[model samples]
Target: MSKKETPLFPLRKGLHTRQAHVDLPPGTFEEEHARQGFYGRTTHLYRLHPVTDWTRIEGPLRPHCYDLNPLKPSAEEAIRLSMFGSTEAGFAPICLLHNSDVALHWVAPDTMDFFYRNADGDDVYYIHAGAGKLETTFGALTYATGDYLVIPRGTTYRFLPESGDQRYLLIESFSEVTIPDRNQLGPNAIFDPAMVDTPELEPYDATPREWAVHIKREHQITKVFYPFNPLDVVGWKGDLTVWRINVKDIRPIVSARYHLPPSAHSTFIANNFVICSFLPRPFEEEEGAMRVPFFHSNIDYDEVLFYSAGHFFSRDGIGAGMMTWHPQGIHHGPHPKAIPLSRTKDRTDEVAVMVDTARPLQATPAAELMENLNYWASWK
Candidate 1:
């Protein structure tokens, strides 16, 4: 991630230098990239107009905190949690876990035609279900089930789900979302660069009409009305851009002699948290080696896992869209039966996404509504 290694995502010519944005048509647009050498990496941007032609129409969103605090981990019985209510819609996503470094959300947008910009930090959207198109100023990215949409900060975009039902595990990183440095794996990226689906330049010219582009900055949502759609960039080129990758395209590293730690499956990393995808892989086949994860305490991180699909051999009764949290200082592991059951199996099809944060995470009120109160007793 240096000046020399930035050519891996060149969408066009002349965008490697500060003069990169000067080549665009002079009028009717503004250069809007991020200069984050102070923060992390710089992202160049070009927008139809200065994204500042906005009028704040509302107050900040409700504080994201919970009333009841739960901190128990599951050993055998699965602990379930939900974020979406029966009728939540639009840009309103349920905040499930939060701390100083990151905030995790469950978003199911029923009507998603409006634009949105996170003035806060980078966002990683894990699509648990549904298919749709994400139109952003950088370009258009087609997303489906198992796709993780990585959007940088300050990018204006809108999501259009083919159907009204869509489930997303959204992680708002209070810093840049970067690829994990797995130099030990090889000189290549953790996931192959060829597997990434970067958006191509597909500009849309909407007729003059009112559009609501919500801007979230400093924990507040300001509804800004614009004269036209803001995602009108005809071309963009830079190392900093939005991209998508499906879980199926990711090949997990496995060890038959020993159980691999969660870090072996690392996908993306930020300042204080790391996101990993647990895809289908072969189980440990060696004799006397533990097939299930051994009991251990999360001494330095808070772990959150969202079950995506298939049978997870380590836990029982877990379902799709369910989430489990194991905060710092808690010891958790497979059910008592999972170890013996895993010995009878040679492979697994479980697909899950994990977020481990260095800082302790606080649960939201919405997450408390679906907690399995008897989870702690299951180990008995």
Candidate 2:
């Protein structure tokens, strides 16, 4: 079918803007392009996620959890040692929701492998730890802990480690992922211009390379098909390609006069939802403000959080590697201890990625086989 003649799926409404106040020094983009050209060498790596016929793949993959104890060589180990080791590799546990549209992936440290693209659905990834290079048809995009990446349906890509040892937390959504709706703000505005911090595309070396494309079919998975790598295209000039922006670049819209609602600093779209973040800044109402996230309900969407770093004062007993899924109907917020422990003024060192979806999410059998069942009753 002709490109323009193809039917288009209606995308939910929302806006994603780069922080206007941030500036990229002259030649930064060019420098990044050059660096990628230099250091990125072509590889013949190929792998695929197991799949079954849609008719046969129906039903829930039982839910489960995993702990990366072996991977943690030391309490202070920042790099994930578990994921890369062959013994515990594919064993990366995941949580599966029966008959829903989402799956939670928890990768232990030091794991490096090909993340197969979904042929039948879109996947959004929320980084939980370490850093790496995502090589895609568009090019290489660098991702660190706390980054969120959306790989639209049918986009082929793979992961490469930026550091020798690192682990990752990945959230895979089978449905279209989007920002929350702006209507919640009552029509004027939310996501203040100052809150978003768009990272400058730091210059990198670039070089030409070739990649192999593998197509999977019922009879047998095909392999070794050569496709001209886009990285060889030498120059790129569009936004429909892979890119990276630091979470810190997303600035919070602070109110000088009144305590702003979480929705005030929120950026909304559809298919899924995301709340930008909070930084160390003065609260609108008091010189020493100890604010906590108010309890709320998402009638239509499931709420999931991937804690990246820092202390989450609002939610008690949560630390890095913890995955919280507050499905519809659950009333969840900080623990009782958190209520009395609120600080008059605080500096937060936490970073995380939060998602709320309008449609119910499903967990794959693979996911069910790897979840931490204990979390199911932790809300109390």
* Candidate models: Cα lDDT each: 0.69, 0.44
Could you give candidate 1's per-residue lDDT for residues 223-335 as a string of tens digits?
Answer: 78989877767676679889998999888988777666677888998987889899999987767455666454455667788888999787766667677787655446676
Alpha carbon RMSD to native, model 1: 19.1
List residue ranges in candidate 1 displaced over 4 A: 1-89, 203-205
Please name the candidate that would achieve the greatest lDDT relative to the true structure: 1
Clashes of each: 3, 55
Candidate 2, 99-190: lDDT as tens digits: 24444554443322323444534555556566767666555676776665666665666666565545554444456655545565443343
List TM-scores for all candidates, in order: 0.76, 0.58
